[model samples]
Target: MGELKLMKGNEVIAEAAIRCGCDGYFGYPITPQSEIMEYLALREPWKETGMVFLQAESEVAAINMIYGGASCGKRVMTTSSSPGMSLMMEGLSYIAGAELPCVIVNIVRGGPGLGTIQPSQADYNQATKGGGHGDYQSIVLAPATVQEMYDFVELSFDLAFKYRIPAIILSDGVIGQMMEKVTLGEFKPRWTAEQIEQMSGSWATTGMKGRKMNVTTSLRLQSEDLEKHNNNLQAKYRTIEKEEVRFDEYMTDDAEYILVAYGSSARICHKTVELAREKGLKVGLLRPITVWPYPTKRLQELAQKAKGMMAVEMSAGQMFIDLKLAVNGKTPVEYYGRMGGMVPSPSEVLGALEKQLIGGANNE
Candidate 1:
């Protein structure tokens, strides 16, 4: 077994960044997510692995910093809450339009504005639907547990670099604050400038010594050229949708009712599924690991088998839109959610499932 220790979710994000060979972390402190930077500061990984951590002046500045570092092909990242993320939207658009690879973590809080510091999954639409202007998609991962909070940092970087697209860890305050025993993985050495040049030199702006200079920007003045660029981006997103969809299904083989959710909501729905099964209802869970490049194909398959599906979220039915689209009227799709940082209990979810999908006369 690897090293095991009990740790808060936010702290592990820091540990994972250092261990995964991150070049830098440029972020502003925000509620619930502030510990990510604090933990990094406490560990002082620059002394050990030469990692760099800078608390930026603001979220906008921090996202631009991420764009700058990613432009050079460095594995850099930033973290923020909902409102702070709103400030970074334009920069996120620039990075995506430029097609740079980087990781971003959003420890979601409730809201349209400065909603609350309480945990929420309300950022689902923003994270998956490209909150930034222009047409683009980031590889979005939702972690339901503290272990995933650690594992996805490395995975997000790998996927981001592999596709040269941004990756977002769509976590919430619940996972960020919750403590759990996580098995630490082996460390990867930070990449050298030489290594970065060797790996990403084709498009990365390493010093233009031996080859043609690499120009990175999102500005395409010509309409036709911008259209072509957008088409290319769309093609990349299609490939990702085909190749990188990830999810976990529980008790699905025999299930007649399916509960679809992601992140913290998925954890609650899992218990709801069990509670339902104990009462002789055939319920299952479809927990999405990758919210973007969503597991639509699997959901479509589940729709054929299950009597009905319900999407549960911490948002006001954001992912429910996707769930319904995926099921495509083959079977009924219902929604259960809580907003403004309220979390539903397992019993509440189970009650919703019965009322919405199972107990209804149409479902029966």
Candidate 2:
């Protein structure tokens, strides 16, 4: 039987990593997110699963260690918040450049600088668009609850290993700190010795002999080869967009105004929906679960039926661009949000929606 309990989001992630058969975790402690490391350290996940947990010197070192582990085609992961995630961007760029498999969790905090320990969705651009200097993208998953915190981390690991690309979990303080019920799936062992031998035979860096020489570095000496690598990466991204888009739609069939948001902010939009209905307004919500894929198709489909969309967020308006791009100019995309650890209240979103229709200052 599966075990269900109220758990912290960070602890859920650490436990899920073990249950998912992740081979190793390398990360440094950062505020709000530090609990993730503490949980793993206390649990000693390695003892049960033959996993490895390394508390690296810094976020930079932690991600590089992830890089090293992933090169072996192993299931590896790491976690941090905004500022620390910024430190790992250099390594994130390298992981994407090399098309290696790894999972990263960013328990987002307000940012631009050290920001705050409180939750913020301001890293929308940093996680969606390549934050680091890169011509590559990571598959970004945004989880709004502790349940998704556990589940998305597992799925992100699977996607990372399956696609041989990086997977990122973008979450905020509301979800990270909120206690919620979650079911721990059955524990399973990682890749067997035979499986590892077969994988190592081809892609892994287990020493070059008895077959062809193996190379695991991201650098390309020849310009033509570099171009080929970049082109290949783009092709892979296109494939991912087609295959992995996910979102949730609420009461959108006969709606006149739509609310587009993701992560913890989407929950607040739920309340906004109810209030909008109390006022007899046709309001709905479109919450994107996968941030990188951006659910452009879903928003475009909603555009054909709805009048306009209010793009709500904890950031200024990052997801707004996505809503616009998704709708492809079919409707005006408006925005209302606050940053630096402030959770936009339900009333605030309702006010924005009301202002949009009455004041005519919004999507028109």
Tell me, by TM-score, which candidate is best: 1
Which ranges in model 1 have alpha carbons more than 4 Å from their true place?
Answer: 361-364
lDDT of 2 by residue, 330-351 (tens): 9877888888999989989999
Q: Name the lDDT value of residue 11 in candidate 2.
A: 89
Find the 10 residues in a row with the least total lDDT in model 1. Answer: 355-364
lDDT of 1 at 239: 97
**True lDDT of residue 282, candidate 2:** 90
TM-score of 2: 0.97
Error of 1 at 157 (Å): 0.3
Model 2 lowest lDDT segment of ten: 355-364
TM-score of each: 0.98, 0.97
Candidate 1 yields a Cα-based lDDT of 0.93
lDDT of each: 0.93, 0.88
Write down the TM-score for model 1.
Answer: 0.98
